[model samples]
Target: MPAFTDIMSDAFDYFRAYALRALCKARAMPRGRIKHLQLVVGRIYNLLKKEAAYAPNTQQLQDFRAAQQLEAALDRRRDDGSAPERGFAAARPGAEREAR
Candidate 1:
């Protein structure tokens, strides 16, 4: 079986992707605001940190770093517009077009 750390990491990764999708496609309500996205990212970041504290190897550490960087960029998008492209780039993965 996969290590517990691996499992948690995968779960967080999926949730991060889902949150980004919601941010990108959110309409006039709950998901459209940067504040909402920021909140989600904050929670995810905390969870990621807790998992990384017990990360079994370097690979997991690297993955956590990448996720943290993305989370920071998302936070910046909530603050300033300089990272919009990166934020949107991260906000959507695996597609050239965003969902409507």
Candidate 2:
């Protein structure tokens, strides 16, 4: 099973992408305004991380540091073509038929 944090991260990322798509396609928002909204949302998300970062025991501290390092490494690897590109990707045309 995935960790709760992993699930929540996926959920938030999906929602962010959905919102951006809606803003671009339906609302025709400007890119500058979209970027500003992303920044603000990111700042608010960081507050949640901050609130959970205090009072960690030695083991928890180690795990937290390791997770941070792993995330950074994965992000750096993102440009190496190891990660699949997801932008604008969508389900196949026949997916609905398959589901039915």
Candidate 3:
């Protein structure tokens, strides 16, 4: 299987989009929503990766490996779909996930 980073990032994108839609509705946006979003995405990715890697080998692990492999293969496509804002410039704490 491929590195965990690709797999986690793709999964995060799917869930993050859904979450953004649900929480984005408001005349005045909640404070730090974007930052909070980033943290949630990171946490989900780490949790999934940990569950897949640390647990004993099993059918679930096999499934995880396959999904991660597919994610790596489609990384370019996935990244293009999830490109960050053009004008957003800042090294936010915990914004970037650690490479596995």
For all predicted structures, in order, the TM-scores are 0.33, 0.29, 0.26
Model 1 TM-score relative to the real fold: 0.33
Give all candidates' CA lDDT scores.
Answer: 0.54, 0.44, 0.45
Best by TM-score: 1
lDDT tens readout by residue for model 2, 1-99: 988666444434544453444334323333443334444444433433443344323453454445445434543554374645444433887766766
Comparing candidate 1 with candidate 2, which one achieves the higher lDDT?
1
Q: Candidates ranked by TM-score, best first?
A: 1, 2, 3
Give candidate 2 regions above 4 Å deviation: 1-54, 86-100
Alpha-carbon error at 91 in model 1, in Å?
A: 21
- Residue-level lDDT tens digits of model 3 in 1-100: 8886655544444434433442342212333433354444444444554554444335544554554454344344334756444544447666555421
Least accurate 10 contiguous residues by lDDT in model 3 = 22-31
